[model samples]
Target: MTRNLLSILPVLALCLWLCTAASSRLVKRSDDLDPLEAVVSQLSQTVAGLQAEIAALKSSKADNAVLLALQTQVRSLQTITAEHKVAFLARVDVDVAANAPIPFHAVDFNVGNAYDPLSGIFTAPHSGVYLLSTQIFPQFAGDVLVDLYKNGGIIIRMRVFDSTSPTSESTSITDHANAGDKYWVQVNVGGHIYAGAHSFFSVTIVFPDS
Candidate 1:
């Protein structure tokens, strides 16, 4: 009976040791699982934050592109507006019989009594540089005086003289009259009297070909 009891005691002790070892292993596994879960949660949060930042950056870039396009369109519109303003003026040519009374040509601007038998008038259609010229027949030797007037006031006066019968005189007005500006030319008879049949003259406004 004593031997049986001692053998049972040793078997009971071995069972107790095995139970303790199993409990320790279960605790260790639980601690490791908790840490792993925390790490995964932190990684997920970081990924989400990065995605939000990327979305914001894309939105900002799109807005800037739209604004730049609008500015370019505005500049183009301004350029077109300026071009339309310059097309209102028309260039023309006039012919006058030499030694004849000054012929009247109607224009947009007002004309005063600034005419000589040999002098003629031209009106500005718009404000810009104008090249004034006259061609005369060679039979008459005389000088021509050109006067530019604005609002009934004289702005410039120039003189050209040639002894040869056929002569041409030219001048340029950098800041020419605006629309309705008036201009006229005076023929200086000098020594020769102008015979209505023998003298002929013409005036032209020079322009670049479009």
Candidate 2:
């Protein structure tokens, strides 16, 4: 665009000079004045046409600059959204001791590497609103207590008990957590949780903190 403008400037200046000279000669010359008058008229029209075209090009350049800026902003937003994404699904494959974080060793997926199957803990990678959930059942089933912990503080708890068969219970919570805050599902009071698909835990980011 800049090169085009530079190239056009010289032509525009020459046209203005020719138009002015023609107009002056039209006034001074009486013999063959009709030819001179025609030339002046043509030069005047060409100068006007060039001016309008330059104005239009300037307007188009401004519009293009604005569009490019908007596209850059959108790409930046998309990168942030992708970086803030967090989610995990894990399940306990062995009994967990009471008063300990359930080591959900069987992982279905952990998108952002926030959830550690080794420790059964999810450390937030970004500050955001999150959804945390779990389901658990005692293998022998006298009674069991499952607690959802956030940074070692109990957020909620569930109790499951059955005399004849295993009883399962599920719980979920949604709350805001800062980056590096921890979350885990734990056995609070009663003994071991049943191994297998009956016990599961999950964490997901609902939205990123702006």
Candidate 3:
């Protein structure tokens, strides 16, 4: 039995050595690829590189598209803003602190240099269709008569009667105007108007170059 085991061990060792040498030879053969296979591998790598470049180019085109769209939108907004304007004025005085200033003065927001606080006039900044609104609130129980004038011509009149108290009366007009056209609110000489924050005059450009 011992001699049989020793002989089997020698056969096992010889088999292992042959297997290891065969594996090493196979590894070297795999490392030395044929010319055709090498060219195919190179072509595969180039194709992968080209695919990556194509993907990058597509991504760049998408980014450029988004940037162009944003630029166009910004330009449109700029044009609209340049053509639009608004002015607002409200009276805050109750009586003539000194003497009646005739026309009411500015007490609230004014934009685009459209309204003049000292003259109480809105001169058009561009040729457009304008919306003019006037609000009147009397101080005492009396009749109110005020007119909205364009270039010294009356366009709208607001008439209201508050016997015991003051109620707000408002009127508006949409008028086509040219650049430098003048607009204002006028009260009749006999009309009694109360000046307070509730009274407002406003103008807005609704359609530019209309």
Tens digits of per-residue lDDT, candidate 2, 82-185, equal 88889999998877888888899999999999999999999999998999989988877677878899998988989886568778899888989999999998
- Using alpha carbons, what is the TM-score of model 3? 0.59
lDDT agreement of model 3 with the native: 0.68
Residues 91-129, model 3: lDDT tens digits: 645442222223557457777878876777788988888
Question: Between prediction 1 and prediction 2, which has the larger lDDT?
Answer: 2
**Pairs of colliding residues, candidate 1:** 98-199, 98-200, 138-165, 138-166
The backbone clash count of each candidate, in order, is: 4, 0, 0
Cα misplacement distance, residue 169 of candidate 2 (Å): 0.5
lDDT of 1 by residue, 103-205 (tens): 4332223222222222344555545555543222223466655444444555555454666564544444544445556554433343332324333223233
After superposition on all C-alphas, the RMSD of every candidate to the true structure, in Å, is: 21.8, 5.3, 17.0
TM-scores, in order shown? 0.33, 0.65, 0.59
TM-score of 2: 0.65
Best by TM-score: 2
lDDT of 2: 0.85
The TM-score between candidate 1 and the true structure equals 0.33
